[model samples]
Target: MKRLHAPAICSWGHFYIGVRNLMKNPGTGKYAASLTCTLLLAGMACVALGTFFYFYRVKPAATAGVLNNIDWGWELSYHLPYVLISMGAFSCLFSLVLRKIDFSGYERPDVWLLSLIFITLLFYSISSQIRFLDNDEYEHLHNAWMMKEHTIPFFSLHFKHSPLLEWITVFFMSLQNPSTLIIRTMRLFIFLLSCGSLCVIYLIARNVFNSYRTALVSVWIVLCNFVWMEKSPEIRPDNLMVFFCLLAFLALIRFHETQRSRYIFLFVLGSLLSFLGKQNAAIFIFSIGLVVFRHVLGSLRTRRFGIILITTGITITALAVLMIPHDIILDIGFKHLIPNDNKFWPTRFLYKILEKNPEIFLLFVAQIFLFKKIKTSHPIFKEYILSVSIVALAFLFLMNRPWMQEMIVMTVFMTLLAADALSRLFRKTGVIICTLILLAMAIPANRRLIKKYIVKKTMTRDLITTETILKISGKNDLVFDSYGKPIFRHHPLEPRYLMYFPEKFSRLELLEKSRTKFLIKDSYYPRLPQKTIHWFENNFRKTKKDPNIYVRDMAGRK
Candidate 1:
């Protein structure tokens, strides 16, 4: 690893030379512009590091000793304005830097651009330290906690989501020290996957578009998106799935360039890994065939077309039979959510993207009227088009419900289109115009990023209730969370997912049969049935003076 990274290391001397070169080649005001840009980037880097330290100052232990008591609302309201003003200042400054910097002397994968990505991601992910787990995360983490005994994930994060993520969680959990907080290590895992995803996004962009600036812009566009920023650090299965899908996409793009059998093997490996991560990742398998379809069409009567179609068909079948035969529910859903929203139809989909994800949407629209000329026969052009087509069509045709984080799978294609547009725009108007356009795009994205990923505080109620549960309950205390969550090491009143299907077994019966030490609703757990609420009213009283908590009454229970 050291040998591989040796050539790309960014030394201070390199920057000094870069600066000295700027000073020497100045027409008039270039030196001052370069110095100011340097100062602003440095200042932003310090703020990012300082913010991370400020939140994580109190180190996490076995208990949640790291959490703070600051009102999340107060924190956001107090600092958000200052954050935005500062972001705008640096964004404009960096745009000037891009406009004036002599990047001609720098080589591919510019060290400065790479450093910017690393710093921004490092800052962006620190929010995971304070961010509360959503209700789905509670379920997902519970399954992960149960990984020691149950590796199958019979009723998983979404009841039917794949088990690879839970398996990986088990490996992380196994490696954690008993003295340290397991969740903190899990946070590190999520952070690593988030970083890996962005780095691959850069690689795919560079390969497809063949321009460092385009790749850099695409990475920023993806990093700044609201959904990606918000869900990037989550414990959900899709988080891992997104990383694998990008690998498959990049591998297939590589294969298209050099019909190597190794790339095909890589494509298969990535597709299988992603499929095991989440079923939705089958979109990538479909995309692979479409992206390589042109190559197959020429030999439609020959073995080539047969090979591609047969490979795709076999892959889909293998993934389906991997678990679907054993769990038929994997291929079916309970129709939990009906699409009554504005996006129920295909026609309104782009319009919704326009409203909710305006930055990528606009850039993609601009890509249609590219600012520079390109040959239609180019391999990159064809790969880009087919990929965009297959991915967009898959979303429209297959999604039972498509919005928010579901679009994470489509980010690569959207960013690719955006990068192509920026490349064309830069060709016509130079780095100044492209830089201005990028900052303009990231403004709204950063607005969402600040509100959702940075300043915004969430999961306060869960944090309070969880801490209280840990304090009041014994190691063997039986827990009954309607949401099927695990409270650290507490005993569960019944099989966790039994609550997921209330009709199969009466929760009241389970409660009566077990010790039923405590119940934690925590605001967002599913509401109890009327009879169960009545049963709880009779047998339990609030523990820790928290209304959301219910502990057994000794007088009644004994």
Candidate 2:
């Protein structure tokens, strides 16, 4: 027996030696050099294209404010050149660095890539701190304040959305005074969560595609998205939901691969947390359930019935333990889903795709065409497609319109799928080209985001107008403004006024009812009657802050 095995062992040893020598051979450097040159040339070409577009297309749009147009088609077309150029430049540069740059005895490439993503997201998140709170943010701030002040019970906050966001906000507000700075604090928390989600996206991509580069590409796609950039830093539940959803998916993938009870426990934990973050996260939970069902069915073919059955039992038990409380919370908070009666849901969806996220939309279309090329047998592929379909269909049924924020679950799956499809379709060089192009297309939206959040110091005219009113009014003064209750709630001023429609109520009627000391009006309200305007001008001293805002003090004679 020993004599018979010796020849085979010797042959294997010789084969290993030959392979080792081949790897160490000097000739391979030539291939690396050639690849490096190719990448460098690509990068130079991209830079040239980016320069051209920056000058011709992006610069003009920036100057003309055409990028802010409501017409999706015109906006997309106008920004296409810049998008192409930016994407090209990015691809070219990335390829060159990957191929030519060497960092021996340092952090692995994957670690470096993740670090880069972390830094980029961190910078963006910090930049977002300066952004003025939008309407939804102000509403969240009000709710959080209410919760903090014990005006509303933590469990009984009647917001139709998930309570986790409010809970988190309240928790943070407890640590500090609830002021304008609370807005920044909440945003910072959300940004941190968003960064975590990005990391999870990279991990999930790496697990599914088994390539660091693919994972980096997946993250890059997400990073380039204007919606993600704008929304991630807002005081909202979407980023938190994305964070937990990505964790749940990551755990699901691990469970599938390892068949471990611990992963199942984690998956359940993540799913529950995700659901708490946003009620819509149930879509991801349902998708995970479908994947488990598919796996159970597959196990029957492989004759692992007993093992699969036990796994399924453990998964179900874990889910039940977490889901019981989740369901109760959701049942209490659940309200009517906002409906879009426009009957043009598909058209609006298409318009959003064209207007805001053309690059992602195109990649999705490309993914469809290249579906056959994607391995159908792969669990990640099957799970992602199934999950995306389930969520998208549910969203369509519930809201008709493809509301972008509501579609975050679908977006994550689609982003991963897009990454996978891109990997299959393009080699390293090609991947860079495709990535940069998509990124460049998204540049216009990002430019607008930068301008709105980063560059601009002054608030919107409406906000400035409102702030002026808040600044000028006394603590005990009753100020009526067209902006409505949010300003009163946010400013914590006494004698709050609810009458926003100055057109509906006569000046005498308004003054008589509330004894309002100051009347503030902005462009947001319907036009004031001529008589009402004249009455204020004749009876009171009128002060104009800007073209948009007017203040009247009844005490001062005109």
Which candidate number has the best TM-score?
A: 1
lDDT of 1 at 280: 70
lDDT of 2 by residue, 248-283 (tens): 778877777878989989988988887787777777
Tens digits of lDDT, candidate 1, 1-558: 343223223322343554565545443434445554554555454345445443544432322332334555544443332333333333334434455444453432233333445346545555555566666666665676666655334454444567787677677767763212445456556766776787687678777767766777778777766667767777787888889888877887788788898998997999888878877776666765665665556558977768888799789989977856543543433232235343354446556556766767677666656524532324555455547544755665455556455667776567777766755566677545655665566556656655665656554445555666766767667777755444354444534543544434455675676777787764534455667767767888775445577888863273
* Model 1's TM-score against the true structure: 0.71
Deviation (Å) of 225 in candidate 2:
2.0
Name the lDDT of candidate 2: 0.56
Ten residues in a row with the worst lDDT in model 1?
4-13
- RMSD score of candidate 1 (Å): 8.5
lDDT of each: 0.59, 0.56
> For candidate 1, what is the lDDT?
0.59
Return the clash pairs for model 1, or none: none
